[model samples]
Target: MYVAVKGGERAIENAHAWLAEERRGDKGVAELSVAQIREQLSLAVNRVMAEGSLYDPDLAALAIKQARGDLIEAIFLVRAYRTTLPRLGASKPVETGEMACDRRISATFKDVPGGQLLGPTFDYTHRLLDFALDAEGEIPEAQSGEPQAAPVPHITGFLNRDGMIEQEPQGDATPPDLTREPMEFPANRALRLQNLTRGDEGFVLGLAYSTQRGYARNHAFVGELRVGTVPVEMEIPELGFAIEIGELRLTECETVNQFKGSKTEPPQFTRGYGLTFGMTERKAISMALVDRALRWRELGEDDLGAAAQDEEFVLAHSDNIQATGFLEHIKLPHYVDFQSELELVRRLRREAQATRQDQQEAAE
Candidate 1:
């Protein structure tokens, strides 16, 4: 029997060993603890949870460490880990009106029924880097605010009093998951919002930025933004009622975009929705704009064909894990294809050279 090259199993094992070594880096250095990652790299963890569609900060922190601080890679890690988790039935759709907010703010009105609360935000922080982090000793003034906290109220309830915005329709009808279904044209609001929440932060930000640059320019204002935990409940047919399943920390942004009073329509404010994991205002704001842009067709607005307005383009390449994988994979071996192209060009040049020589000789 003719023998063939084997050791595929051994090669994988050796490769894994090398990868583990590379992941560890310097041998003598104390490894980065998961606690350190969770506390210090919280923003990274927030992003992983936001894009991975999972709210477990501990798991997200671990993924960040495993990815060696590559945030996109960290997101991929979280997504892979998230997918393996067992399904525990569907939770009842979150009631945002009932959310227990930690932070809430509004930019739309000066003084509403509920006073604007500028919750925990980095907006007022100085731009200088702190040198204190270089030292091991902790800051003496680290005041841990009461671990036992009260739930803050939502800011949008004030606007609802005057009916400034349209009241959202409540439905027990199950929402479709964009991940499970292949994207079809004319996506419903639920499906579109689902994709946008898990979409790549950078790509979404760019599309949102483009709107300000004039392509389907949507004049938008932050109607409200809130961050906190909301109870996720489940309605059991057997139980005949809903029960609380768990809670999730989320940042929700609703932008009030410009709309004209049409001949048949009344002057009503349009909504741009963004709901993401953790305290991520910028991402939430960007998401809202992109969300609004995607709804142009449904809103009876002209098809400007803007990048943000293109559902197929935006939804298809929105996930960082998918984009990064496809983009980075191109760096791997493509030698065979390169060799064939190289030979084809070389043969074409040689033929051209002979043809030129023949023409010159005939003229002589």
Candidate 2:
């Protein structure tokens, strides 16, 4: 049974008020608006949205402001707020093939149908920080290009046509919602993907790195990586057809892995997929590597006992909110528990000292 600490309510309230003052910082300095955070610190907002499992950038920015730039705390706030929202109708599966891509590239191919559009990337830039941005200056407008009239084809589609890659399974049945239902062991690919997409970015990245360092290595190649806006559609019961609701900026990464076929199948390439909110290419790529690693059993491959391959271990600890909550709880008043432990240790030490003295006296 959990006992409530009764005397610290006033202290807690004062602490919160002090925290609000600290959050505001110097009065001389300009206060940060939510718009600035939403526009300028977009990547942080994206990470919060992805991990929090909520797509509202405005709310994310507000949370960021309230949390005093503590992203994990912001994510915690967003997630807590998300739970109170009423569930609306589910949208139809997003057609990524119809995505209006801003950036699309394939490491495997020299040139794709839609030529590699570099799109705002830091790939080739010098690592040195620009001091010009430290002072107020009007930034020059970036060069614009004509929008591509043709839809960018997925790189994997070409490989699949030649029967080189393993085919993705098709199902119309609605997948289990991990948010609503308790996660069970032996989770299907859909459930696993849901977990990975919303999982802690650092944890996922580390696991992905481990795979590259030969922990259940699945020689993954970036078949394609694309960042774009896709239309979200929902079907109305009154209207027979689905209507476009909104657009979401998404980053998708598809990795082709070498798969020497089993007895029933032919030697073919397998695929690992990752899709995340906004331009989170690093997270998407990392998620793909980890996703592929977790597919060892499904692919009829040997269980290599890698941490990434352990689904229960990965899913259980991947949530930052859950992890931080458990970790931070130790700082709270555990006086009763600690006191019991202290008494036990003291009693054991006293008995041991008494027994030792008696033994020494008897020997003498």
User: Scored by CA lDDT, what does every candidate get?
Assistant: 0.81, 0.93
Per-residue CA lDDT of candidate 1, range 1-364, in tens? 2223454688789999998899999989888999999888788889989998888899999988887788888888888887798976788678776667666778887674445566667878897897887878866764455442444445555665687655567766778886677778778888888888988888899999999799898898898888878999987778899888789888899888777744444566778899998877788999999998887776778788788888888888887888888898777666667778899999999999999999999999
Among these predictions, the greatest lDDT belongs to: 2
TM-score: model 1 vs. ground truth: 0.86
- Which residue pairs in candidate 2 collide? none
Instruction: Please write out the lDDT profile of model 2 over residues 1-364, one tens digit for every residue.
Output: 3456679889999999999999999989999999999999999999999999899999999999999999999999999999999987899999899989988999999778988988889889998999998999998999998878978999999999999999998878999999999999999989999999998999999999999999999999999999999999999888998999999999999999998986566789999999999889999999999999999887888888999999999988898999999999999888888888899999999999999999999999
Clashing pairs in 1: none
**Stretches > 4 Å off in candidate 2:** 361-364
Listed per model in order, the count of residue pairs whose N, CA or C atoms clash below 3 Å is 0, 0
